[model samples]
Target: MAKTDQAKADKKRQQDKERQRAKRQRDAEKNSSLGIREYRVTLSQTEADALTDLCAYRGGVEPYGAAEFIATLIRRDKQRMEDEKAHLGTCDFCGEPLPTGCKNGLGIPRLKGVEKCFYTRDEKKLRL
Candidate 1:
């Protein structure tokens, strides 16, 4: 059954909230691992006024409510860089296309006159 417009909108908002929470958790973990902590600072009268004006200028979305946006941006940028590297054709020495099965690894797939892709070296031995 098709969802109503309001239902779809509510679902989207819920998803966005979940994603934001996840990002915040990840960033908080990273900070905690580094023995760091986050703190809120009190702004001066002028600064607070400027911040209030800035927040108001932001249409629809609340600026201070943008939790973990910076972390999400960083994650996306790293993914994009990795994808670019993956698309750079096969290895010249081995004549193998890059592997796309998983993330955080650089194992390339080799034709090597075999029926299917094979690795010259065992992935477990290799440092991913």
Candidate 2:
């Protein structure tokens, strides 16, 4: 069943709230290991007002998420990475040309016959 736009916005709002909570918790912890460092950005009154106005102005089919915009930022960042990778025909994480026919990491000819993809070096690493 297709969800209505209001429902989608609600879901996104809930997701944003959860992400904001997690970010806040991580940012509040002292020397936390979540790798989510909180940056203290001080803005003048006018600058703050301008940012608020911008957020309100830039809102789409959902509520203005203020500084806790998760979907927009993540989607934009992913799109940027994909665009760059496509343009260069290489992995964004590792600046190397993609394989011609190799499906997985098989040591590409450029890497001296070393086949490494986006996950070859990252998938096996310790991930929490």
Candidate 3:
């Protein structure tokens, strides 16, 4: 009876380990498919302390960790930039009205194979 009980316990432990290994493998595959890359950031003692304090202050039922807080900040900044660009209602590159249609919408300069309107300061004059 003792040997049987021990065998059952060992089998259950082995099954649990196998289950955990499978879960980790699945997680790794999912992350790879999503193109998620992990980065290691080193912070000074003061910075780490500040981050901890900020997280604690912002904590409620669910607290924000340092990574979550930083990601949120980045997302907010990106949205703000997009909003500002749209509000301008002009081609970012040529500084002309977007209705005229510029090569690149975001004002980013294309180095190779520059379009005719790329250097044209006044697209309206160029058309006439």
Which candidate gets the maximum TM-score versus the true structure? 3
lDDT of 3: 0.69
TM-score comparison, 1 vs 3, better candidate: 3
Per-residue lDDT over 18-71 for candidate 1, one digit per residue giving the tens place of the 0 to 100 score? 999999999999999999766576779997777666555652375633234434
Q: Tell me the TM-score of each prediction against the true structure.
A: 0.33, 0.34, 0.47
In model 2, which runs have C-alpha deviations exceeding 4 angstroms? 1-34, 44-46, 60-62, 89-128
Q: How many clashes in each candidate?
A: 0, 7, 2
lDDT of 3 by residue, 1-128 (tens): 99999999999999999999999999899999999766799999999999888777776667789888878777878887667557647655556654435545556434223454434443333231
lDDT of 1 at 97: 47
Q: Candidate 1, which segments miss by more than 4 Å at Cα?
A: 1-3, 46-128
- Model 2 clash pairs are 105-115, 106-115, 107-113, 107-114, 107-115, 108-114, 108-115
Q: How far in Å is the alpha carbon of 84 misplaced in model 3?
A: 2.2
Cα displacement (angstroms), candidate 3, residue 9, comes to 17
Report model 1's TM-score to 2 decimal places. 0.33
lDDT of each: 0.57, 0.60, 0.69
Candidate 2 has a TM-score of: 0.34
